[model samples]
Target: NNMAEAIASAIISYKKEYFGSQADVNYDKTLSSKAAESTKSKRIADNKVLKARNSNVVFKVQFAAGNKKIKLNPSNFKGLKNVSVRTRNGSFYKYAYGDTSDYAVAKKDLKEVKSKGYTAAYIIAFRDGKSISVEEAIKL
Candidate 1:
């Protein structure tokens, strides 16, 4: 319901005299103000969206690390379908549905992947892929 309507309903529902000689109208005003303040405080808190300190951190763990595949934390790579891995030298590699398409092609095209200078790689979702530079990836 609307905030104004809710506040009005609360004022009406409060168990205090309204029309009698013992009616406490002043108390009703204080109660309404307190409720309004509480609701406003809650809304302000909920509106805040916290951002991650390290945005380059690729939560994915499973990737072909040379001949031997290396998997980090299983929970980190969960529900990841399409992903794009970026190398240190501004090269991009894409994979979908657990398919690592043409590792040789990626390795050849992305000179950074082959170079030891590559600081880090990012495995982000294709839908909401995180776009971060090599410097940021290294921080992750």
Candidate 2:
């Protein structure tokens, strides 16, 4: 992906440089305007693409506690792959099935789960089974 990005950038730059050298007055003005417009359009497109790629897909977790609820964010767990909710006192609970259910269970468990200073209800971007920055994940 990096290589592809580099090549695409080179091509765009090459086009800009090549077209910037027109001899005709009208042709040069038109080409320059078009190039500038193209560059602006590309920048906007790139921003959208980057935002989508880096955007995080968050999974909320909630657990039950008496009649209350506890919400757990991604940071609550060290390894989030096999997410499960259990009591901090050493009692294993059931695994949350759906995204909503899992988040609910995690929220409920938050009361018992010790916090390591992570925020609640935020997005988490992952790539190749490894966590990535939100900006990078948004590209996906």
Candidate 3:
């Protein structure tokens, strides 16, 4: 009796943690083993939301930010992967480069980008698509 209850609770917790919302629980009550596999399958689905396979936080170099109609070109940062431009507020756009889950790697990346002519580039971290500091990102 408690086994079913335990499985249900575990599934619910896993769903809420990974999916950010409730999911339809339609598993057979008699199959506790199947529930475990279902939970593992769900983790795979949530992997795309992650920055790195293991890290929930990552650092990027914010090369530009403005409220004007100015365009931000992530393509300008050549040879860099994970280059992206995201809007924080409704209007202001922020351009960033690099996707590293490690703080030391990000710090080194900052230096490398700086040397490559991005003199003002700096590290800005993100977890689940929200801006954070390198220190905070490392903690996550």
Q: TM-score of every model?
A: 0.16, 0.22, 0.50
Off by over 4 Å in 1: 1-56, 59-93, 96-128
Better of 2 and 3 by TM-score: 3
**Rank list by TM-score:** 3, 2, 1
**Which segments of model 2 are wrong by more than 4 Å?**
1-119
Give the Cα-based TM-score of candidate 1 against the true structure: 0.16
The CA lDDT of each predicted structure is: 0.31, 0.34, 0.53
Q: What does candidate 1's lDDT look like per residue over 3-122, in tens digits?
A: 686567546633222222222222222334434543443354244321223433333311322221223343333333333333322222222122222222222322333132222321
Better structure of 1 and 3 per TM-score = 3
Cα distance off (Å), candidate 1, residue 48: 32
Clashing pairs in 1: none
lDDT (Cα, tens digit) per residue for candidate 2, span 15-100? 53344322322212232433443344334435654234222343333211211222444444443333434332232222221132
Query: How would you encode candidate 3's per-residue C-alpha lDDT over 1-140 as one tens digit per residue?
Result: 65676567657744433443222221122244433433433344244333334466777765544444334353455555556776534554555667788555665776777676655566666788776534345445
Candidate 1 least-lDDT 10 residues: 61-70
Report how far off residue 118 is in candidate 1 (Å).
16
